[model samples]
Target chain A: MIIEGRTWLFGDKIDTDVLAPGYAMKLSPEGLAQHCLEAVDPDFAKLVKPGDIVVAGANFGLGSSREQAAISLATLGVGAVLAKSFARIFYRNAINIGLPVVAIDLTQEVAPGDILKLDLAAGTLTRLKDGYHRELQPMPPHIIDILEAGGLMAQLKQKRGL
Target chain B: MPQTLTQKIIARACGRTTVKPGEIVTVNVDLLMGQDASGPRRWRPRLEELNAKLWDPSKVVVVSDHYVPAVDAQSAEILNISRRFARDYGVKNFFDMQGISHAIMPERGLLRPGMFVAGGDSHTPTAGAFGCYAAGFGATDTTAIAITGETWTTVPETIKVQIDGALGPEITAKDVMLWLCREMGMENSFKSVEFMGSTVSAMSMSERLVMSNMAAELGAEAGIIGVDEITIEALKATGGDYEGAEAWVADPDAHYYKTVTLDVTKLGPQVAAPHAPENTDDVGAFAAVKVDQCYIGACVGAKLEDLQMAASVLRGHRVSPDTRLLVAPATVRVTEQAAADGTLATLTAAGAILLPSGCGACAGMGAGIIAEGEVCLSTTNRNFQGRMGHKDASVYLASPYTVAASAVTGHITDPRELRTSTRNAA
Candidate 1:
């Protein structure tokens, strides 16, 4: 339930349309990440390294229920998405797809390219540089159970042997 | 506890008498919906992984809508995947040539009152107009539901939106929703939204769908409308033998987290400016902004009456030389009806280009895509920074009437202004 990675900062109200632009929808699953955030950060697909973290302001993923928003990020191998807040469906999609999303006030704590650590189990986040940190509010137990099993699908498979 | 509609519906789906906000419960979905753009992407292979046939094929509805006429080999592949899933799983309600499921489901009697419907596409909330607790979920969730006919949700509190008085003759549900978002903001983001009052009861299913579909813009869990005689009669009129309709009204003492009321008589046509749906203003204040394209597409905006409104505005008039008008009907049945009623001919004579019966410009998938740096007054939902292909191609969301009126003037003109102007701008 703990992850550490480089930071990729974005602003508030990042919608799903730009998260995975509709024009790039025909691309294969992994190819979707290639266009992730290309509207705002044209070089995101070319520049993002695996296991990176994305931090943003309030109402992150504030648009459609296109799972592409979360899938594109998952395909990019993001460690977690730390935001001031999240739109409800996007929050559910992230957890259902095994992406740890925490709502916390961390916009002033870390900078882009800074290494930060997140602990979903203990509800905490720590900046690897200055060791500055804060605790996050834990998700509900049912959601935590899904995240702990690596996502809803894996959790369902494990529990029901589907 | 006094139950809101969300509590009542969720309780019924979960086999409980009552439920509360943030209570996670397993639900028995009455129907599962998947669109061509999203369904074929995952569910088929996932069902194979689970070694399962569909829990009950009769309850599944798959509509090939997003990329109709097959934009490419890839689009055809997705369409074929939907067909294969339907055929292989024995899903009885598969409609490939129907244009859009949001309109087709209700028109075909698949959507009804007192049902728990879940779909893969975001605009699936449109189905909630029939008094269903319907909302959009992802493909993975669709896979799980296909396997077990069940899903889970954390029940949300209700934000009851009441529409009082009569709507102005020029006003449409699109304006009503934009006004609500502008006034309340997305403050009701995580709550269930119910549209009620005299204005709503008088509005047709199309009008109600327009209001419910915008609920997603509020980030609502489900945009709900209570079932009344209008709902039942709309179904009966469909000629599809829709007899299962039931009345599901909120109790008189229903508990709502918040109540917001609007007198439509006092409200006029409204429009949302570029980049956000909540940043809205009256159409009368919009005059000098020239437009490159005027589009009417998506399930929310492209119904029969919407086309009729646009056609009436453009009856003998031609579209301005500088502006291009694109009409994409939400369903094939709507297109046929318009054709039968001469609405299509009127629009075509006015120089409107008709796209397939699906989401054409809404996602910038095929036709109606605009150039960079151009401004478009569109009827589709979402005016995100890069929504319609190019990030700089601005889309101003409004009702079909506002879009049509703007088309005549080649600028953002008010629909009410067209009441006097007899001729189109040259």
Candidate 2:
């Protein structure tokens, strides 16, 4: 699948609290989704449309491992997460929940609002139209299996005949 | 060709007899996990669309940690929904109001060496203290574990933290971790960190737990203090039911991506400022900052030793009239024993407000939130802006002693400075 979206660039260590702040957590996922990235960029949620990608620096998803962080992004229709690195929990949670999370090392060249296309199978993140194209280390085949099946539960259901 | 504990655990889980450094392997997991704030409820419809059933029951764990004691009716209802899901799914490893899942997992024997673990909680990596290939996942990923007992991991390159020197009295593992979080930014190593030092060898099981528990705060995929006598004793005390107790340490020549050193002598009381946990500096840096709330509880603060340290500082001295002090025990056992030992009495008599034995008020799940612009000095992990209930509220993360001393004086003050008032009252 080639995911086409606008890029929302964030620096390293963008924590869960900032992604989906705790105060907003009391609200529903949709409600919280509106405030996603409000702590960093107040206009983030209001300006973005569906199929957007969040490109971040190293250690993305750095605190609490709260699924709300991933859910907030997904509900906002963020098609995928591209980071230099991901916090272990956030990375797994994102993939399990079917949010495509990819890692590329050239975070220095990616800019916010740059339209990009991510070919999950090709391990290529190409800047659509004006963005730069960079290759990423693709997730393993089994992980692609899990992601394609729409996370762990679906993968298990297919495997165990559930 | 020595293998690191991480390599060994990953290799074993994947059925590979040996794992050389930097070789990637797919592994099966022993357990999958999630908690309330970031559970699979929103993703449930997606799972249904995908036509999935719960995976292996024995390998799944769901906890109601972030909103325990269900502060508001909404939170209570949310927890009820989670509980109903746990019951309907026949998932037996559910923990509600028991304590932080990271703290309770080891107590319940779910974390063991040579096992791979993933949780929806970032601190899920806390289980790596058991020498397991443990990491945290997001809700979507946890939904996979809830339905499947495996996760894919690129074998992480290991980083070694070798600590030495002696820990002074009042210096706890929390300080060591905070020191690491500071030295290594909250994402310092990216993945795989193992702690080995003379000081680590000298630390108790409780101390090591604290050290590994906060490893995620540094953005590590997993953190471990090499298994030794203390680990064996700790596992035994927690019910010795684990099968691979001896397989918890690394071989001597294991490869590491980077190696760091902490002398322990250079460490002191650490405090993380609001909006970020890694904004940690020496506690003394905030000596004049006023506090509106003082909280001591959560996975880190609930230890008996932590309470005793706070009690020792608060003994005979009253908390400041403007300050509110919230004391929560990490576990029921610690809560019960503290009451029996009069430690609870000493804290309460000194004007500390007692809360239940869960992760109360730490994650802003219930109570203890400060007013807008108010500042709170807390003993829990995470000081991210807007973390403590109100987006405008500010929090300073500190050690238990610093929290108590600051509470008594209504401002940040070193514990040593409070000795005069405590002695005068006596």
Candidate 3:
């Protein structure tokens, strides 16, 4: 699996409350994307375009089990979230929602708005601007299998012969 | 091979005799719960995709806890839809207006030792107090359970926490947890934490809930306490069958990567400073920090016992003129019992505003919204930026006792200083 997108850099432990505030708890998924990251970066929802990517320090997507944190990002058409590490549930939530999450060191390799190409099989990330490439942590077989089946729903449906 | 309680539960659910960390397996979920906001709204679409056949309705539960009194038309409609869906799907295990299911589920005997329960809400790991492996996931995973009654996981490594020494008369579980977060920095956010040693064995069932409820706040997958007398008593309280609960304890040689010890006797009332649960200091460390809101609720801090502790401190006193203190019981049932026991009356008399039972302000849903630049002292778990509504509003987390004492002074006052008026916790 390979994914390509422009980059958005964030700091460590960028929690869900900043990603999806409680005021939007009643809003639709699309409405949630509009307010996603509005707490930390007020222009996030309005500025994010589809196929953009999030790059962050360790412990990204921390706090809360709200799927909208991942939903809003995916809804805004984020290609992937490449972080040094991730919170347990947020990582699963992202994959279950069909959002690709890659563990990589994109901090020093690329700057804001730099395009990135991630190749899962080769375990490499290429910076289109500078052609600087780096190896990333490989996705385990189980995660890849689930992703291949198109998230949890598709996997369950396929397993159940639906 | 020896295994931790969480590992054993996962292995058993996977129908394997043994498993190790980093190995993946799909296991049938023991229980799955959701609320008005997270339940059917997301599941409806996935259910339609799966042709609407529920794998096992008995294992699934829908409850109306969020927006319980129907704050708006949308909330009211969501609650109605939850009831209708439970009826249409024959899911008999449903709750309405029960407050936080994180506390209600165990109190009602739905969670037990050795079970692997998944909830749509993030705080569901509170069930881990029963020696079960419980974690929170999104509604998409909850819907997957509806289809195949199973979810997948990579076994997480275990970290052992050895708590020793007797707690001070005024110190409580809340203090110990905040101290742990501060000292440990929430290590192993994707790992399991197993509590061992004398203090854990001596804690009451209610006390254990205080620990387990905050495990998620530490970013851990689950926190397990060895099943013992308190565990058995918890099971007996709800008339739950606990014939095999004793076996939930980890084997003698279970694998543990690290050990963090806490000497309760040496610890004092601690508070998590604003912006993060892991940011902590001695209660007196922030004596100059005044507060605008004082909250005692949420799954972690609002158990009946917690309410009793706060009421004991506020029995004949009033909150300071500048401070606003709020006491929210964890559930409707707790409300009735507290009222009968005078806990409610005491808090109300002390000018502690009693809010309805539900999870609101802890997640910034608005039962107690803070003004910009306002500071709050609370017993609720987590104090992230914007957690209590205003991003500029700060939150300080401490025990109900500390919060109650602070309510009277309108600043971060230590509970020990008011010893003449406060009752002994033990």
Best by DockQ: 3
Please, what are the lDDT tens digits per residue for candidate 3 over residues B341-377?
Answer: 9889999999989898888688787488787999999
Per-model TM values vs. the true structure: 0.96, 0.90, 0.97
CA-based DockQ, model 2 = 0.54
Docking quality of model 3: it rates as medium
Off by over 4 Å in 3: A160-162, B420-426
Q: DockQ for each candidate? A: 0.65, 0.54, 0.71
Local accuracy of candidate 2 as per-residue lDDT tens digits, B1-426: 687888888887878877755465656878777777766454466567667667777777887777777767888887887788788777798888777787778877776666788776667767776776777766666665565555556777788999999987677788777778879877654468898889988887667777777887877778876667777777778774555667678888887888997798867777888777778888778877989889998887677778988999888789999888999888777787789999999999999988876666667666676778889888887888667766788888878888888988898877766776667777
Winner on TM-score between 1 and 2 is: 1
Backbone collision tally, model 2? 14
lDDT of each: 0.85, 0.78, 0.85
> A55-151, model 1: which lDDT tens digit per residue?
9987899877788899999888898998888887788889889999888757777788999888888888888879897878867888888888988
Number of clashes found in candidate 1: 0
DockQ of 1: 0.65
- After the best TM-score superposition of candidate 1, give how far the Cα of residue B402 lies from its true spot, in angstroms: 1.2
